[model samples]
Target chain A: AQSVSQHNHHVILSEAASLELGCNYSYGGTVNLFWYVQYPGQHLQLLLKYFSGDPLVKGIKGFEAEFIKSKFSFNLRKPSVQWSDTAEYFCAVNARAGNMLTFGGGTRLMVKP
Target chain B: DVKVTQSSRYLVKRTGEKVFLECVQDMDHENMFWYRQDPGLGLRLIYFSYDVKMKEKGDIPEGYSVSREKKERFSLILESASTNQTSMYLCASRIRDRSYGYTFGSGTRLTVV
Candidate 1:
């Protein structure tokens, strides 16, 4: 079975600090990657996705992810963090023609203002 | 914008009681899914539907069933709600191409007592 791994369980950052969350998946095939964010008491929203072409994908709210096929990684990054960016981030992947996705353990980010 | 709506924000059920978690999507998507989010386990898929009246078991489908009588609605049922089933349930919808990210609902937090 395919699985995703997120290296960080919880991360605390001061405002304006750089942010990066590591994600690795155990799948060896054409894959589609995604990043989702869940704000406090809010629903999960798509941050970004990678289907094909570009390896680096930019998303809303200054978020971005890079799909590195060789390393099986799709790491989420932000140049600077803000309090509003505090949320739980999840990394998900599915086979190119697969119907379901496998999600990582998730990284809980706390941005301190 | 796509919208996936779960029927409840929170629910409390007794053990051994039947529980139903409802979800509806306004985008007329071809795929709908149910997932349970835990602190460390992340989002574990419970079930999924590709079309009306069609359902497939996911990674964790034991003790759970699903219904999809219409294209816009999907329901997750717990035959006998157990304390271990307490978690946040999320509903999501996606197009058939599998190129885009999923649109998720606000989630229903179910607690069995």
Candidate 2:
């Protein structure tokens, strides 16, 4: 079975701090990777996705993720984060021929101003 | 933008009562998914439908049933609500192609007491 692991459970940072949330998947086949963010009282929104092209994929809000096939990792990164960026982040993986997705435990990010 | 809409933002149900959570998407997507969000468990898929009347069991589908009689509407049903089932239910829609990311609903927070 394919599973996703997020290294951090909770991350606290000050405004303008660099951020990196680690994510790793356990699928050996071709897989699609995604980072989704859930703000307080809001739905989960797609932050970034990696399908097939370049390993480094940039997404909304200046966020980006790199898909390293050898490591089975697709870590989300941002140069600077704002107070508004405080939210829960989830990493998900869906392999080829797989009908559903496997999600990580999620990381709660708290940005202090 | 594609919009996936869940019917209720919050719901309180009694134990053993039958509960129905509704979801609708306007993007004419071919795939719809139902997931439950818990504090430490992230999002666990309950069920998914690839087409009308086609349902597939996900990671956790013990006490849940689903209906997809219409292409745009997918409904999650709890045979008997339980306290353990108290969580936020999210609905999402995606096209058949893997290139498109999923669009999620605002979610329904169901509290079974």
Candidate 3:
């Protein structure tokens, strides 16, 4: 079964701290990767996505993700996190095998002021 | 701008009641998906429709059914609500040919007691 795994369940960091949320998927074929974010009371919004081109994709809010085929990982990263970045982050993977996404358990990131 | 909207923001239902969650997208997307988000489960695919009147069961479709009567509308139906089924239900839409990534709704928080 294709599954997405997130290493950190919860992460707390001070403002200006570098942030990295690990995401790994277990699929042998070509896959599409995505990073989504949800604020305290808002909808889940797309942060970044990787389909074919560019292994590294930049997204809104200064977020970026790296898609590594050998590692089977598409990790979300930001040079610095702010208080508004405090939210839940989800990593998802999809393949032509099925259009459904396999999402990780999510990482709760809390950035302190 | 693309917008996905859920009919309800919060809902309370009895354990044996039938529940309907409605989702609509203004983007005229071809693929619409229903997902449930829980604490330990980031997002479990419940059902998806690739086109009007064409539906497919997703990973966790055992307790749910779906409807796609029109191009921009998809509905998730819980045959019989259970306590264990209480979770945040999200609806998403995407254009199949252009991009596989999704634009998600605000989500409906359902509570079954």
What DockQ score does model 2 reach against the true complex? 0.78
Over the stretch A10-34, how does candidate 3's per-residue lDDT look in tens digits? 9999999999999999999888899
**Each prediction's whole-model lDDT (CA):** 0.95, 0.95, 0.92
The DockQ-based order of candidates, best leading, equals 1, 2, 3
Candidate 1, residue A29: how far the Cα is off, in Å = 0.5
**For model 1, how does the per-residue alpha-carbon lDDT over B25-73 read when each residue is reduced to its tens digit?**
9988999999999998899999999999999999999999999999999
By lDDT, is 1 or 3 better? 1
Model 3 Cα RMSD, Å? Answer: 1.2
Which candidate comes out best when scored by DockQ?
1
Predicted candidate 2 versus true structure: per-residue lDDT over B1-113, tens digit per residue: 99999999999999999999999999899999999999888999999999999999999999999999999999999999999999999999999986567899999999999
